[model samples]
Every structure is written in structure tokens, then in C-alpha cells.
Target: MSTAVGGTTRPCPECGARVPVDERFTVWCAACDWNVDPGERQEHRQKQETEKRRAKRPGQGRLEEARRALARRHGERLHTEMTRDGADLRARRDGASVLAYALALAVHGVTAALLAGGVLCLVWGWGGGLMLLGAVLLVMAVALRPRLSPPLGDGTVLRRADAPELYALVDEVARAVGTRGVDTISVGKEINASVISRGLRGRRALDLGLPLWEVLTPQQRVALLGHELGHYANGDTRHGRVVGSALRSLATWRYYFLPTPRPSLGEMIVNAVYAVPLLLVQGTLSLLDHLTLRATQRAEYLADREAARTASTEAAAGLMDQMLVLDSIDVFLRRESNNAALAGARSARRNAAGAREGGDLWTRLAAHLASVPEHEYERQRRAGARRGHSVDSTHPPTHLRRAFLLTGPPAEPAVVLDEAKQRRIAAELATARAEVARSIVRDGVA
Candidate 1:
């Protein structure tokens, strides 16, 4: 028998070795599982065998390699396209922010003018004074509005003085991305990390909370930071601040006209007199908030893509999963806290009963106040408290985000785990849970 190599065939030197030749001049020996080369006389035989193998294993190694090369090239192309798209988005957002600021200033200017006119009208006993006063109050409320800060900034660097391991990890990631180190890092109660830009010129800062440090694994923490850094890389932080400020201003103006109780009888009189104007202000603010939210949603999508690009998609997915788990834990804790509070209230009531025999004047007053229909008020109060929580909740709902990250392009499949990746993800989850348990044991979370 003859085998072929490189367009030639020759007799196999090794007897009893099964020599199979191919058209491409490749030879396979079955008995010894080695390739053999036979010189030119067997070339026709070699070609026929090669054709058989090609038919049997269509588009094997070389073809697969070509496909992979094409995919890598495509990925590079997409990265470039996305980078340019991100730049365009940043430019557009910057313009929008400037426009919003300008509009806010214009509104403020009009408000100032109206207030001046109102004062003059007050001096002259003009009927327009009330309308002008309402407008002025609305503007003041809008101008001084407060809101949850946007979750963007250069994150605080974990120092050796604070958390050595976390600091080291953050430094590693920062070096990998070739960015300036996080500007600041602080320990906070909420399980969140954010990048914030401050001052008129927007100096960047990173703020990390203590709960995240206590809860997340090093991988999870790095992933979370990468997501935030993605925001920074895309200039989302500065633009987010502008959007947040604009939304806050609108919300304030809306609240000014809404039916919240007045601080005093005189204020109530003024509010009642100018209710219609207040409603208009509130309506306008609500419209602005809707628009800002739309922009915010787009920024979130871009940031997610950036995170996936910089880190692995799996890492981004892991971070989002961790966020959802943390959110559930927070909700559970909040409910438990509320229950504890109710128990404390009951204990206080019993103590009051013991002290007063039945009910004293103060107790009766408290009972009467509690008996008033205030379900809406209580709900609003709770919502306000949740808003005041230090956690950076600027992102959309967790479940929605997870779905977005997990689903990738259909054509180029992601690594489908055959047990190993699944195990690793499970181990990570277990570690996170253990950390949370340990933190609870040590700190006795309230």
C-alpha cells in the first residue's frame, strides 16, 4: 500500500500499517496511527482517498479557523462602530444637557421678572400679584430642587488604609482599562457603587458603599466597578448628572403645585388662590421628567454595552445577577424592619396603657391623630424614605437588566456551559451568600 504527502505518494516503509491516501496528498495510517508518505506512482490513489475524507469531514479545522478569524474581525469592527456611536451619543447628550440648562435658566429668568412685577403690583394693588407670586414660588421650588444623585463618577479608590484587597482589585482593573484611578472611595451603608462628577466643571469622583464591600466577592466587585467605569468611559456620568438635575428640578416644580399641606395658614391661602397656575407648573414638570427618563433609559443601554465590551459579557451578567440578589435582600430587610417597628409601637402602646390606666389626654390625642385617614400620606412617606436610601438605584429594574445582558447575538453563540461555567457561577453565588451571612452575624444589620 502507498500513502501520500504534499502532492506525492510513495510505498509505505512500515509493513502492516494501514495507509490511506488523499487528493490533498495527506496520508493516515490506521495500525500505527501515524501519517505515511509514498512517492508519485500512487498519486491517483492518494487523490481519490483525499476526496473521500473531505466528503466525510466537511469544513473541518481549516474552515473552522477561517470562521473564527472572520468572527474576530467582525468583533473588532463592531467595537469600532460602537465606539463611534457612543461618541455621537455623548455629543447629542451634551447638547441636550446644555439645552435643558438653558431652558431652566430661561424659566428662572422669567420667574424672577414675574416676581419683580408681582412686588410692583403689590405696591399698586394689581390683581396679577397672586399669579406672579405663585409663579415665583414655583420657580424657587424648582431651582432649589433636590434629587437622588446620578450613579456616575470616578469611583473612590479603595485604599490600603480602608480595604487592601478591594483597593488592589480596583487598581488592577483600572490599569487594565488604562484609565485614571478612582478619585475617591467611601464606606456607605447601601450596597452600591457610583461615579459622580461635581462642580460646574464636573470633577469626577467614585463613591462605594460599605455594604457592597461586605457582600460581594472580588470578581463581583470588579465586575460592578467595571460597569460603573463603563459609564465613565462613555461620559455618561457627566451627562447623567445633567439629566438628574433637570429631572429633579421638574419634580420640584411639579410637587410645588400638588396638594401637599401648606406650612402655614397664609401659605395655604396663597396656594389656594394660585392653584391653577401651580397645576400648570406641575404638568410642565411632569412632562420634562418623562423626557429625562427616556434619555436616562438610553444611557443605561449604552453603559451596559460598554461594560460587556470592556469585560466579558458573562461578567456583566454576573454583576446584574448580583444586583438582583442584593435588591431582594434589601427588600426583605426593609420588610423585617417594618415588622420590628410595628412590634415596638405595640410595646409602646402597652406601656402607655399601664401608665395611664385607660387613656390620658396625650394618649387620646395620639389615638385621634392615628385614627385620621392617612394611608396615602403614610405610603408617600415610605416611598420618600426608600428614595433617600444611599443605594445607587438609577438603573432600571434588575430583572429587565438581567434579560438584556444574558441574551446575545443569535449568529455568534456565546459559550454554552457544559457544567463547568455553571459550577463556577453557582460557587460565586454561594460565596456571596456566605459573605452576606458573615456580615449579618458581625454587624447585626438593623
Candidate 2:
């Protein structure tokens, strides 16, 4: 039988063993395990053969050699072009992170300083103290906000294994782009998701509500996760958290000086003395809160782009569509619940009317105060009343968020998806919905 190696025939160079002529040209000598330069050997052989043939047709070989050289040069040029494009993308991403950090810090510092100044002015009996106080209170509320942490395990692969298919999709996209895996995936009742990061270390996590799972298709879920993850990838979490904490501390200081209802007259007097400064503090906090929220809005836009980059543009659009539908459903539910509660409250008031009218002057005054419009009341009173608490909460209004996500400018590289993938996603979504329904039914039975 004939054997071949390296397209040549020769005696074995490494050993005195008699081998097939073709096998002697192997890249590695079988007997001694010595390495051979295949390319160099092939080139040497070609050159020798060409030299032998050159005597017959020297001009003909030149054209073939030149064509080979041209092809190598073209390949080198293409490789260089690809490398330059990759570098340009990296530069742009880095620039974005730098800009986001600067904006976050500036907003935080300005808000804190304004709040301190306002409090000082209020202490000096400034006329705008009340307004200042209100503003400061608002700022503190946003700046001092605490986010719920999503629980995650230690191992990345293991944690991902426990996640839903949507989360897995997020992980794949992130890994493909050489970004960090999502920190956590939490299930909540509301149809919402958010990314949060804290401390100087930049520890981040993502919260995804169970209700959102029910509402969104698989592709939409992937897009939403991509958006939240993008915020982390963009380094928004750590910076945003720092800004929030600073604002909160300033607000807390202002609130500390504000008077609250107490049993002792001396305490009331003491609180009253600090009222002006407290009001100013409140105003400063409010301004900070407004700025923070605005920054949040911008971050949201950036995140949307990131999502589009990780997933398809259509996936991003689908996410927005699902969010809008969920918001509408939530609004309807809230309105219905509110109407029911109001009716129940009216009935309770009617029942308590006879008993409430029969009290001492102080008691009657307290009862009358409780009946006052909540929106016009002091912060403490409004908080205590608990009359439709959701309306007064921080976080962007749902309708506005949905609108922005749907219509926001494309700010990152576009991703593409095909019809087969879309079909598979739809099938997965159907399965998820069925599983959810089964679980709900099982729970009801139990």
C-alpha cells in the first residue's frame, strides 16, 4: 500500500528505520517525535521544482507568483480594517461610561449643596422656607431611596441554570459581547423590572417581576432583560446609587429639624424653632430628587439602546408594546380598587358620624382635621393618611416610561433576529404561560 505525507517523498530523516518514501515527509517524525516545518519544506520543494522548470519557461512562473503576493496583501488589509473598527466601538463605549459618571456626580453634588443652603436660609426665617422645605423633602425621598435586592447564588453558570429562559437569553447575549452576567433575577407581583447597583465596588443586580413574565413574550422578555443589563454594563448602577445616597442624607438632615406632632409642649416649641431651616432643607432635597429622576430618564434611554444592541430592534419594540399593555391593565385594576375602597370609606364614615360628633373640643378638632383634604395636608399627615399611596411614590410614571421606550432614539448597534428564532420564542412564551397557570391552579387547590 502507498502512504503519503506533506505532498513529498523522501527517506526518514529522524531515524535509520526504513519507511515509505511519502511518509518520510511527515510534519512530525513518527520514530523520534521531532517537529518538521511543513510550510518551509513545501516552499523549498516548490522552489526546487520551479528552478528545474524555469530552464524551460522562466517568464510563465512570474505571473503566478505575483498573483499569490497580491492575495496575501489583500487579506492583510481586510484584517487591519476589522481591527480598526473594533477599536472604534470600544472607544465609544468607554466615552459613554465616563459621561454617565460625570453627570451622576454633578447632579448629586449640586442637589446636596442646594439642600444645605436652603436649610440654612430657612433657619434665618427666609420667606421661601415652606416651598424650600417641600422641594427638599421631595429630593430626599428620591435620593434616600432603598432598592430591594435580588437573591442570587455564588456560581454564574449555576445561577443561570435556575433562571427562566429569558434570563438565559440575557446571559448568552452578555457573554457573547464579553460583558458580565446579570447579577440577579427577582420575581415580583408587579409588571416591572429594574437594575440596581450599590457601593464603590459596583455590585449590581436585576429585579424582574413575575407579573412581567405573564405579560411579555419571550423575545420581549429578552429585550427587557437586555435593557436592564445594559444599565449595569454601562456602569450606571454604582454611580446612580452614590448620587441617591448623597441626596438622601441631605434630605434626612432637613427632615430631622422639622416639627412633628408630640404629646409634650416643650418638644413642639423646640421643633418650631428649627422649622425654617427644616423647610429650606426640604426644598433642597426636592430639587435633588427632580434632578435624580431626570438622570434616571436619561439612563433609561441609554439602557434601551443597549437592549437593542444585545437583542434585536424588534425585540426592543416588543418590550415596549408589552409594557404599555401591562400598564393599561394595572391602571384599570388600580382604578377599580380605589373606587371600591372609597365606597367602603364612605360607609365607614357614615357609621362613625354619630360617635365622632359627640366629643370634647380637642377631640372634635382632631376629627375635623382628619377630614381635611390629604393633598393640602402636611407631609406627615399625608403619609399617615395612606389615601392612595401609589400616586405619591417615586419612580417614573408607567405611561411615560412605556412611551419613551417605544419611541426613543436608536443609540447603540442594531441587532438582527430571524423568523425561525421569533417562532421559537413564541412557542417558549406559550409554554411559560401554561406553566404559570398550572402553578396558580395547584396553589389554589392546595
Q: Candidate 2 on 45-102: residue-level lDDT in tens?
A: 9888987787799775786566445534433342233234233222122343455445
TM-score for all predictions? 0.46, 0.43
In model 2, which runs have C-alpha deviations exceeding 4 angstroms? 1-161, 164-167, 175-179, 235-239, 251-258, 262-264, 290-294, 331-446
- For model 1, the local distance difference test gives 0.48
Candidate 1 structure quality by residue, lDDT tens digits, 382-413:
33322231112335544445445555541121
State the number of backbone clashes in model 2: 14
